[model samples]
Target: MRNAPLGIFDSGVGGLTVVRAVQQLLPSEDIVYLGDTARVPYGSKSPETIRQFAHEDVRFLLDRGVKTVVVACNTATAHALPSLQERYQVPIIGVIEPGVEAVLADPQAQRVGIIATRGTVRSHAYQHALALRRTGLILHATPAPLLVPLVEEDWLDHPSTHAALHTYLDPMLDRGIDTLLLACTHYPLLVPVLSKFLPDGVRLVDSATTCAEHVKQELTKLDLLAEEEKAGKLEIHLTDLSDQFEDLSRRFLARSPGRIMRVSL
Candidate 1:
């Protein structure tokens, strides 16, 4: 199974952050990525709907022969992971758990701020995950649904973006949150702009990056890390062609994002 390509999926181009991390960590492994651009922003949908969509996504990837699946979108992680796990045989990794694990492990972590979509924050997934165990950690969650559209527009460095980000974070920063979680995959692209508004002491955590690290370890343990000779080939499947799925993804992934095969639900 080491030669089997890993499957990664996101609501849109945001998951490219996870793909970028995967590329850096496991350069030899081929990946099959799917961006559900037609149904972008799973944050606002119901759990049943999200779960159904996620199942279709998993089925799509499984049809292509993946050894593992990476859930790169926070919204789907909150609402869809459980059902996906029940239906899929391969190992499954989601963005939330690994991110929370990182925050809990930080020695200096006192208060952690999470910036995510409205649905993610409302689900209280992170808070519930951290609350199950006593870790003496304070959680500050902010829902910034607008950022998703802004990131899609490639407006990460826009002055307006800085204002919105500052509005969401300044309160948490003032409350002494030393670590900030980029709860949404797309948020990482705005890290540079976020840093300008945030205090120097604050650190931005990429859940996708941490998730990739955990995924690599899991794949290695399972003897599924594809060799170098088997790489340089990738498959991209999309639910639809709207939202400039190809163009925006290219900017975020830093590649042309070749072979975006389209599929209907």
Candidate 2:
């Protein structure tokens, strides 16, 4: 079981951020990544639909014999994590709780701002988790649905992307948030652009990185950590494929995603 690959799925290439983090942290563990590009932008889907899609995604990964599953999509994690955990016997992790834990780690994160997809914002997963963990936390969350398309389009430095970011974050800035939790995996790619505009003291908590850390911790606790010394392998699967998706995958992974296969999930 230690040699089994880690399973991760997302609505699209955005989840590659989680894959990249996992690869960096746990170099010896193999990974199987499924990008549901055919149903990209799950943020607009209904809660019931999101849960159904999540179940299918997990089933696909489990079929591939993964040791664990990571719900790298923020919207799916928000809407379907509990159900996924209940339905799957393997250890299933999601991006939301790890992000909330990251926020609570900082004693100074009194007023925090969250920017995620519409579905994730609607789910209130982050807010609810933080409320359960600690008290007196002032939270502001907004849906930045535009940023996902912008990032997927590779418009990290585009003026329109900056304008959209300002439009989403300006209100949070006005509220004097000390920490900004990037609830979506796709948002980490915008860190450079975000740093250029955010104030000096505002901290950024990236869910992808935190989720990877949490995965490592959980695997260790479960005695499932791979004991190999060599670098791990990665497998890329997508429900749909396109030239744009190929390019976006490369950008998200910071390297060539070799031999991407199209699968019907």
Candidate 3:
């Protein structure tokens, strides 16, 4: 079971952030990634709707023989992670909690800001986590709904993208947040752009490095870390392969991901 590939899924290409981290951390382990590009941006959906989509995504990954699953989408993680973890016998992880834990561990944090999609912000995942563990800390949550769409459009460095980002973040700055958590996996890509606007005292926290370490620790504790050095492969599947899809994915992933095979639930 340890040698079996781990599965990672998100609503769109953003999940690649997590995959990049995992590859760096566990070079020997195999990974299978699924991006629901056809139904991208599951952020605005009702919890029930997001839960249904997450269930099917998990079933699809399990069908592909993954030993574990990681939900890399913040909206899906906020709404679907607990149910998916209970439904699947294999170990399951999602990005939100680990990220919350990471930021709370920061001794410098007094007022932490979480920037995520509408659903994640509405779900209050960060607020609740800090409230439970470190009630004294203040949680300032903001919804930057444009980041994911801009990322999917491959406009991370575009002039229009910067304008959009500025518009979104200006309000966050007014909220007096000290530390920022890029709560969405997609937001990490914009760190360079964000650095320009954020004050030096405010630190940006993203899930990749910490999440990768946590996954390794969990797998080790479960005795599920792969021992084989087999040439682990990457297989990317999307629900719909738009012309824009491959082009954007190529730009986002920095290479043609073999083939973005189309599949369905």
Candidate 4:
């Protein structure tokens, strides 16, 4: 089982951030990534529908003989993680707990700000998880529904993207948040632009990096870490092939996403 590929799924290409992180940290572990692009934007779906979609996504990955599964979509992690965990024997990890851990990792982190999609913010998954872990920790979660489309459009440095960031994040900054948690997988791509505006004292916690670290730790404990001497391979599967898949995959993965295949659930 240790030699089997790791499974990761998201509503779209955003989960490639997690894949990139794993590739950097665990270079020997092969990966199987599924992007449910046919029915993307799971952030807008009902909880019941999200759970159902998540089940099917997991089934597809399991069919490929993955050692463990990572729920890379924030909305799906929020709505479907527990149930998925209950149904599957594989060690299923979600982005929310890892994100909360990253925020709490800073001993001085108080007044944390979270920016995610409408479904994730509405679910209060990060908020609730943080509250359980730390007392007297203040959290403000804002739903930035516009940023996803901006990211998909590859507007990483466009003026409109910068304007949207300011519009969404200025209020949190004004409230004196000590740390800003990028709760969604796509938000990490905005780090350069975010750094241009954020104060030096404010910390940025990226869920993608944190989740990757957490996966490393968990794999170590589970004795699932692959041999370090061997190089890893990445395979990307999308439910629908969009015209922008190649470009967006490169943007998200920071390299050519080799041989992307389209599959139906």
Checking candidate 4 for backbone clashes, the offending pairs are: none
Instruction: Score candidate 4 by TM-score against the native.
Output: 0.98
Give the alpha carbon lDDT tens digit for every residue of 100-193 in model 2: 9899999878999999988899998999999888899999999998998899888999999999999999999999999999999999999999
Report model 3's TM-score to 2 decimal places.
0.93
Q: If scored against the real structure, what TM-score would every candidate get? A: 0.95, 0.98, 0.93, 0.98
Measured by TM-score, how close is model 2 to the native structure? 0.98
Error of 1 at 216 (Å): 0.7
Q: How accurate is candidate 3 locally (lDDT)?
A: 0.83
CA lDDT, candidate 4, residue 33: 99
- Give the whole-model CA lDDT for all candidates, comma-separated: 0.85, 0.94, 0.83, 0.94
Query: Candidate 1: global Cα-lDDT?
Result: 0.85
Q: Which residue pairs collide, candidate 2?
A: none
Clashes of each: 0, 0, 0, 0
Which of the two, 1 or 2, has more TM-score? 2
Model 1 C-alpha lDDT per residue in residues 1-265, reported as the tens digit of each score: 8888889999877888899888888888889999898897798899888888888888888888999999999989999898788877899899999998877776787788988999899989988897675468788999987788888888888887878877898889889998898898888788777777777888778787898899988988997887656454777788887548778878788888886888775
> Residue 21 in candidate 1 has what lDDT?
86
CA-only RMSD, every prediction: 1.5, 0.8, 1.7, 0.9
lDDT tens digits by residue: candidate 4, 1-265: 9999999999999999999999999999999999999999999899999999999999999999999999999999999999999999999999999999889989999899999999999999999999999999988899998898899888889989989888888999999999999999999998898888799899999999999999999999999998566989899999999669888999999998989999999
Task: Locate the minimum summed-lDDT window of 10 residues in model 3.
Answer: 248-257
Q: Where's the lowest-lDDT run of ten residues in candidate 4? A: 226-235
- Residues 43-118, candidate 3, lDDT per residue (tens digit)? 8789999999999999999998999998988889888988998888999998877887888778778888778888
